[model samples]
Target: MNNYNHILAKSVENGATTLESHLESVADFAVVAARYAGMDTEVALQGALLHDIGKASVVFQKRLRSKPSPLELPFRHEIASLFFLKLVSPDLQPFMIDMIVAHHKSIYKDVSGTGIIDLENEYEEDILQFHLSDFSLWASEAIGILAELKFPGVTHETVITEEDAREAYYFALDHCRKRQKGWSQWKGLLMGADHIASAVGDFKEKVPALFADPDVSFYNRKGELYPLSLIDSDGTKKHTFVKAPTGAGKTDFLIKRCRGRIFYTLPFQASINAMYERILHDLGDHVEDIRLLHSISQLLIGEERITEKVIQDKFGASIKVLTPHQLASIAFGIRGYESVLFDLQGCDIILDEIHTYSDIMQAIVLKMIEVLNHVGCRIHVGTATIPSALEKEILEILGKEQVQYVQLSDEVLTLFNRHEIYKAEAFTDLLPVLQQAVEQEKKILIVCNRVANAQVIFEQIEELYPKTKKMLIHSRFKRGDRNRLEKELKNEYNVSPYACIVVATQVVEVSLDISFDLMITETAPIDALIQRFGRINRKRTAETIGKYKPIYIIAPPQKDPDCLPYNPKILRDSFKVLPDGGELLRETELQSLINQVYPKVEMLNIDLDAVFVDGKWRLKELWHLPKSALIEKLDIDSVVCITQEDDESGKYREADKEERILMEIPVRYSSLRWKRLKQLDIGAHPFVVPDIAYSSERGLDLAKTGAENYDTNYQIW
Candidate 1:
């Protein structure tokens, strides 16, 4: 053990981290994670201890000692570590092999591939020269350390001859072909442990516990007891489904049903952001237990607390608010999916607002549900409105008898009726209605189907009423601008009660808490329309229960070939069911209207089986595919947009390159749009937009072309 002190695993600015020290740290963390998962801790500890033993090779040390390491090719230390697996018991050989070889990269390459060594071309004769004199000394030291740590059936005399090393390497290659389930768990634990030890600079530091049994009294105290909350959710910890209108205490009910750590998922980033803030505000004392995860998570969490991003990524919080797409990696068996699966095991998950997703996204969500259930998660789904046909499909998948279905009472639903419906020909027809609302000094909300259309209507309103206070909000704005607008809308419209007009796109549909006196929106799917209606007359109190706020529905565009953003058939059906002449819109009739519009599951035209079939195929080939290949297949092209303020303040420019702010734009901007914008880079910054294209008042100008569109294509999906 004394002789082995000369070997180094990593060279630090202060000094070298000895091979023994690094191995011990990794082993300790690995054992902790493995025991928590109810796995074989001894096997995990052994795998981690042996993972970096190859760094003891004389060639590696020589490379490290070089003033600037002259090695041109990447060192294959993981492959070198495979030479010592013979020391482990024969039954545990497979586990050791999988954990060691796949800790940094995939083990199996292809169905016909020979061994892990072939994946790396660093086996030149010159680099194969080992310090044979020191090999026995280092091996004995490792064995002694393992024994000191109370590892069983291993000793200092466990020799590794050339013959034994060759046999062990071949055995590992054969074991990789089996693709055992235990191997995935073992490999994930080892990787997670190594990452944590490296990030914290020591394994001795206390790692935060991933699960907690906190008292949810804070949520319960402020919560209004709804009919759903009264239903007994204490028995059996079974899956639950709630079909209740918005503002009916559904979120509180979902939280009450959880039995363990929670993963609360939403359909959109905006909704997830809002949910994160809501939970943080309600559970302020347990702030460290909750995390917000999304593309712009760093920005959403605030620049001062950016370290939270690293903490959340390495060790997940007890409660996480994120979009379902964050978990899509598991469905595709992409790299790092194992870590996500590990975090979700035995946790309770809440899928809120599940009805507002595209067909493909819905299919992905369904696949996610099946996988989450398979991993022992207790799923609770809450939605304001879902078609009976889709509801039946979800029930059949969850096993109808296994779920506790709860619905708002018909009498309670009657109390939420607060909208009066009106049919208008187009945006032009709604202009007069808008003017009257403004003259009457009432808060107004107008929603358009597309950003282009929203901008057109906003300009028209601005021109017509020059003296009115108005704001335009959509998905195209830079991230910073959107955050400011959200804060402004919450303060001015919600707190002080002002008279103003807000022209927006479908972005206003989900989770935003502001309520308006009037709303005018273009025709969309019934579910989206229901969500839009919720934004108006949101608080269903005695003062607002019987009073019907007008919600004008404009007819679908006449000459457009594709209704787009929404199905034409669904729009026509939705329009046909609208109450004429501003009739009182009862919440009790909401589900019935949705059933009429989406009578059968096929109406959505989603290929629900496609994701499942693909997932199964990927699982079969999981061992064979490299992570890089998997990531390339799942890559979605996106850009990051920074405002002039962000760029000039050095908040995003002068900070650590990795700590820059990322404001993800909406996904509607296609790759073609990005190409066009990139061509117009105006030299101030390669990606920064021209001054004329963006404004604090109007947001990103989608109508701007050429140089004006320079950095506007920053939409992230």
Candidate 2:
């Protein structure tokens, strides 16, 4: 150990501690392995140590300087190192050659981009040229440096020749070309050693048990979720319908089956937060078993050091709650999917509010279900409203023979009766509706489709209800501000009769716990409307100050010759069949009404093969551009980091910021500061392969965790 420390210290002292340090360390690892292989330990160490001596050469050093000369084009570091090692240690030449050629992923032809590789690729012709020009320069320089430094391994005769060096270079190149792996045998040997070395001391320190088994109590035999209280029997292997209305403890029903390694996929952020809080509160001391895995909650728990690498190397949580976007990433096969799949595999998944996914999003969700099911995961579809088209799609993927549907019974639906339907010619008529609601002293949740429209209705309501207390919520508001408003709304336990109204965009549709007497909503998809209904008269048997007010579905204009209807014609037809001003308590009636509308529409599939036929997108045929530019144009900016402190401001401000490409964002340095930002895993980690946190100017900024500021002055098209 003391000798190892001395060697390590000497290497660092000799300026082998930067990015290139990984190279030298890996070489040492190769030596140890060679010793274990019973192949001349002393000779192997000598060769391995000097193998990267060429890395310290001026040619290689110049490329890694903080600022390279403007006139000098960046030279490949591998060529110089290969030249030096061949001349100095002919006995260990094979191992040194392997390390030099395959270190950079691009140069390794056979295993190029495969992530893991066994051998190195070698090319005959390129090696001849590289040996003649590059190796000669490297060998001469290396010998001179050794002599000047008075190194003990100095050799008088240069064993390298034009033909001998050419063969070695070609052998290395061909080895890489045919290896079909990311790292060469020599390189992996080195990397494994470094990993072991870095973790050696820490092994002695007591570490927390990072992983916990799934809480499988929620699931039953043969892998099916138990139905809600409304059902007389447990859920079976069939397309199950869980239709217990809001406040009927549907979450508990889903939780019972999602026992081990749970993944709660919510439709909205508000709902994700609500579920996270419920799990935290209900689980009590076991709350740590569950991890809130959305962008927002990730930000709140950002500094908790939960990463895919951390999670894989150290088991993190039993349950993870995330949004559809996070779940969608798995199907897309994005960066974190491998780790996510590893952690979530064989776990019980609860897909809450499956009804909220849009057509395009729903297609992806179905694909995700297909993949998750293939991996042996048990899933539960939990929603107040599940249309036949969506249910059929899920059933087809999950297998109609295997799925079970548990819906609300007629008795429960009858007891939870609330809401009257209202029609309006224009949004201006909402004024009279607001007056009636306020006069009755009822809490109202106004839902709008568009942010601009929501703002307009909120302004009108504030002007009319100036004396009455009211609040407005939307996605545009910072998360902190939204939470503040939610807190105020939840203050129902206060002494006085708290009279407050909330006007919000579609954000209010899910996860909010507050119950309202009335809901005035804009025309939207049936699922959205059903979700809006969940907000009003939400709790069990909460009596209205007067009779429970009817929900007003503010329809778009009757005759819009100028524009196509926001509510599709098919949906409008479905609404026409249902009678107005009638009770809508029966589950059969509600399901019948929904089945007629929201039929699945086939989507135009993207030709990914056409786009990537020759390792490039057919941008010219599709978007009239090159593939490189098309790849650069993806917008990842909408994701916000919900950290305790803003990167620039350095305070715990609950605000939403846009996510950036790996090169643009910075990792957080302060542990406390990092935990506040959301979406740290949007890209790859710098230390991990396929470095996600890359910056062209600085190489890879492993220390950054904040999103880049968007140019507010620039118009987004």
| Candidate 1 per-residue lDDT over residues 75-179, each given as its tens digit | 556656777787788898878876787666655453324236444233433333332335554555555555555556666655677666667766765666566
* Per-prediction TM-score to the true structure, in the order listed: 0.83, 0.62
TM-score between candidate 2 and the true structure:
0.62
Regions of model 2 farther than 4 Å from truth: 1-208, 216-227, 230-243, 287-289, 298-316, 491-496, 542-548, 557-567, 574-579, 582-585, 603-717
The best candidate by lDDT is: 1
- In candidate 2 the C-alpha lDDT for residue 302 amounts to 39
TM-score of 1: 0.83
How many collisions between residues are there in candidate 1?
0
RMSD of 2: 11.8
Task: Give the Cα error of residue 148 in candidate 1, in Å.
Answer: 10
